[model samples]
Structures are given as structure tokens and as C-alpha cells.
Target: MIFGNFVSGLIILFERPVRIGDTVTIGSFSGTVSKIRIRATTITDFDRKEVIIPNKAFVTERLINWSLTDTTTRLVIRLGVAYGSDLEKVRKVLLKAATEHPRVMHEPMPEVFFTAFGASTLDHELRLYVRELRDRSRTVDELNRTIDQLCRENDINIAFNHCGHFTSP
Candidate 1:
């Protein structure tokens, strides 16, 4: 009877429709939930490593579940543009790239802000809400690539660290 009751409790906990195969972040570690057993749940890391954590850990730890029905997620990209670059042009390009990206959310739209002014450059920040946090790395890579391409096409120079480059006129 005790064993049956335990099994029943397990079923109730693990049977949560939104609980399994969800992308979740606990602290700095983020992964997709793989399995839920009677005593523990398994998560597969980005590198495909499995982590077995007790069920109690979920209750005790702070967790960010990206798959909890609401798929909206916020993404930020920081960029440093050359000091002389047109701020409005930079803002326009950033917003355009973000909006055009396949994974970026359109309803919420994208925002560009002048975050700060540095010695060699002007720092700008772009914020957008995405539908899935699981695609964070890929989205970021694509965004950066698109930004780079746009910058080149628009003749907007990106700020780089101090490094001497040989020039022959």
C-alpha cells in the first residue's frame, strides 16, 4: 500500500504536462529536461551531458522554466560603434536586423538604445523578446552576423580594441 501511494504521488508530480522536455535554467546552468523518475529528474546540458537531480531540488532551487506555456524571452545584444558613426543610422540598422531575423519576436518589436559613450566608441544596446530561450546561442550568432553584414553594407564602422595595423599608401 505504501509503495502504491508513493508511485501515485510520483505520477502526480511528473505528470505535469508542462514539466517534461522543457528548457529550464537553474542558477547559471540551463538545459532541457529529459526524464522524470520517481526520485529524480534528468536534464541534458547544451553539451549533451546528463545531470540527475533529485525532485526535491526543483522545489528548493530557483528555476527559470522557459517552456512554461509562455515562450516569450528577452534578448540583449551590446555593440560598440565608432564614435563618429551616425547614431540614428546605427539604431535603424540594429532594429532592422533584429526584426528581420527569423527567431526574433515581431509583435513586441525591437528596441535600440544609446547605452553609453566610451573613449573610442559609442555603446549601443539592442533588446528584443524571442519565442524560445533554447535557441539563444544560435539566435545571438545570427544576430551578430547580420549586424556585421549590415554595418559593412552601410559603411558603419564597429569599434575595435587598440591594435596597430600596417597601412601602405
Candidate 2:
């Protein structure tokens, strides 16, 4: 097993599917590659825990190297509004929230999609790209705040699912 793992490690080093500092998701683990050894690799997850995985797993299992070629990543935000809201205005507000954000990419351009007719609302999706993975959280935070403010100002009610059950004799 050691001999096989060493060979697998060599393959991983050369193929470079993931490098030190690269963010990846392998199986149920998502984290940054901290070290690559002859028999195993170490990943530090977002929670700051370190996980050691056998080198052969990289060759056999599917891997997602989020920072392999480029650091750009897409973020999707789903929004639902009251049925009577103005669709055009909602689109404008979502676009405004994305475009005005500093970290959002202008090259790909943000998109607003009216996705579905929900039981209680109109569903919309905001698709935007960020230049770096690090910007995802902050971008979403700012955009959500902006979108909520804009929706309120425009008199758009952000919808929520309501469930009720009653049993009577």
C-alpha cells in the first residue's frame, strides 16, 4: 500500500490537480491544501481543522479544484417577492445590487432571472461572479443588505413560505 501511495503521490504532484493553498472539495471535505506527502495530503477546512487523506484517493475519486485555473467563482442568490410586485422593478433592483458592488465582476456581467411562479410569490435568481473566492462572503453580505433596502424602498415585499396545519374534531 505504501508503494502504491508513493506512486500515486508522484502522479498528483506532476498532474497538479491541486497545489498548496488551492481550495478544493473532495468527497464530503472542502478545504485548502496545506501539504502533499508521499503517502497522504493534508487539508485545512474552513473550521480550521486539519484532515489527512491518502494520496491514492486523489487519483481515483472526483476532485474539484476551485482555484485550479482561475479564482473566479459564481454566487447565486434566490429572491422571492410578493405576487403583486413589479417584475421590471425587481429586476432593476437586483441588477443594481450586483453591479454596484465593488467585488462583483463586470466582465461576465450579472444576470437576474425570474425563475418560477411560487405558491405564494414570484421567484427570482441573481447570478453574479466574484474575482476571488475570498470575496464571496462579503459580496453576498453587502448585496443582501443592499437588495433588502432597495426592495423596501421600492415597496417590494420579500416573500416567505407560510405553512399552517389544523386538526379539529
Candidate 3:
């Protein structure tokens, strides 16, 4: 076991599925790698909690490195709109919001997808790349706020589930 861990550690460090300060997902935990020790790698997640993963597990299990080859990471935001809402306008608004964001990468540009017509709303996904992998969460939040404000101002309804019967007083 000791020998295996040592060997696995070297492989991870050298082959570099992920390195320290990289954003990665391993064994269901997605976070930034804070430390890489001989036996294990430690990560700090969004909540600031440390997750220690064994080097052997890293070698054995599937590891996803988001910033491995590209610091530009795609961020996805799925929003549902009222069935009657205009998709053309939605596309424009979504693209505008993404383009206006400071961290959004302009080279790829933002794309809007009309994914599905759900039970209550028309599902749409906005795909945009961010300049920094670490900026994913913040960028998403800002985009959400901007989308919401724009939706409200433009009188676009973001649909939600009102599945059950309800009475308005």
C-alpha cells in the first residue's frame, strides 16, 4: 500500500492530471487543489472545506481537470421562461448579458440553446466561457443577477413550477 501510494503520487505530480491551484473534480468533490503531498492531494471547495483524496484514488478513479489545457472555462446557466416568451429576444438578452460581463471571454462568444419545452417553462441554456477558471462561480452569479434584472425590466417571465393547485388571496 505504501509503495503504491508513493508511486501514484509521483504519477499524479509528473503526469499532471491536475496540479496545485488547478480546479478539478475528483470522486464527486469539485474544488481547487491546495496541496499535493506524497500520499494525498488536498482541495478547498466553495464552502472553504478541505477535502483530502488519496493519491492512489486519484490514479485509480476518474479525475476531471477543468483548467488542464485551457484557463478559459465554459460556464452554463439554464433558465426557464414562460411558454409564450420570445426566444429571439431571450437570445439577444442572454448574449448581451454574457458579453457585458467583465470576466466573460469574448473570443468564443456566448451561445443560447433552446433545450426543451418543460412542464411549465421553455428551458434554455446559456453557454459562455470565462477568462479564469476560478471565476466560474462569481461569473455565474453575476450573469444570473444581470439576467434577472433584464428579464424583470423587459417584462420577461422566468417560469417556475406551480404544479399543485394554489389560491391567490
Candidate 4:
């Protein structure tokens, strides 16, 4: 069965299930593929550590390729605002933030979903696409900063954990 690894390596080359420089999550690891050998595949993880995964694992385990089809990748930013905040304003603020960011793609036209009502807040999700996978982090940070600023400027408060308090009467 050891030859299975070699065969799997060949399959990868021919099938092109994954490619070098692609960001993928294989089993417990997620990173950019640095090298693909006959018996092992290497990835440089977010922590900057090189991970060597057996070629058979790719054949057996479920895998994800964030940049497989194209360099464009969808990312979601989830946020919660204190209840009673104006929903319309919230949507506009998030939309503007996405549109203003240069790295954010315009075609998908970033969408904001007024998802749920929380115990202490209103939960919403911002879905956007980026041109480069590597820009994801910086784009997120920019979006977050913008959201924080917008929330502050608009007097919208970002909510925290809320729990029912049982008081002894």
C-alpha cells in the first residue's frame, strides 16, 4: 500500500487536484502549498511553519482549495451591534466600507446580510470577494477598522456577550 502514496502523487500531477502556491486546508492544516513531492506535500501555514502531509492524505482526506478556481476568494465578516441600532444605517455603513476598500472586488458588489437578532445585539454578516488570497487579512483589518470608526461616528455600539442574569429576590 506504500506505493499508493507514489500513485497518489502522480494523480496529483495529472489530476491537478491542488497546485503549488495555492492556499488549501487539508485535514487539520491550512496554508499555501510550497512543494509537492512523490510521497509528501508541503505547505507554509499562516504561522509561517512548513507542514509536510503525506500524499495519501490528499487522496483520502477531504480538502479545501481557497484559491483553486481563481485568485478571487469570498470572505465573510460577522459583526454584532447592540439591539435598537438602526438597521438601515448599519447596512449602509457596512456596504460603504466594502466599496471603499481597494482590495475588495466591485463585481460581486459586497453584500450585507441582516442575519439574526441576538440576546443583546443584532447580528449581521458582510460578504465580499477579494482579488488576491494574500490580501484577505489586510482587507479584513481595514474593514474592521472602518466598521469600528463608523460605529463610533454613528453612535452605534458594537455589542458584547449577553446572558440572562438570575437574581435572588
TM-score of each: 0.80, 0.93, 0.88, 0.91
Candidate 3 residue 95 Cα shift, in angstroms, is 1.3
C-alpha positional error of residue 47 in candidate 2 after TM-score superposition, expressed in Å: 0.6
Q: What is the lDDT of every predicted structure here?
A: 0.83, 0.94, 0.90, 0.93
Model 2 poorest 10 in a row by lDDT = 53-62
In model 2, the runs with Cα more than 4 Å from the true position are 1-3, 165-169
Per residue, candidate 2 scores C-alpha lDDT tens digits across 34-119 of 99998999999999999998998888889999999999999999999999999999999999999999899998999999999999
Once superposed on the true structure, which residue ranges of model 1 sit more than 4 Å away at CA?
Answer: 1-18, 163-169
Clashing pairs in 3: none
The lDDT of model 3 is 0.90
**TM-score, cand. 2:** 0.93
Quickly count the clashes in candidate 1.
Answer: 0
Overall local distance difference test of candidate 2: 0.94
* Sort by TM-score, top down from the best: 2, 4, 3, 1
Worst 10 residues of 1 by lDDT: 1-10
Better of 3 and 4 by TM-score: 4
Q: Over the stretch 37-79, how does candidate 1's per-residue lDDT look in tens digits? A: 7666778888999987666556556877888788778889999
List of clashing residue pairs for candidate 2: none
lDDT of 1: 0.83
Collision count for each candidate, in order = 0, 0, 0, 0
Please name the candidate that would achieve the greatest TM-score relative to the true structure.
2
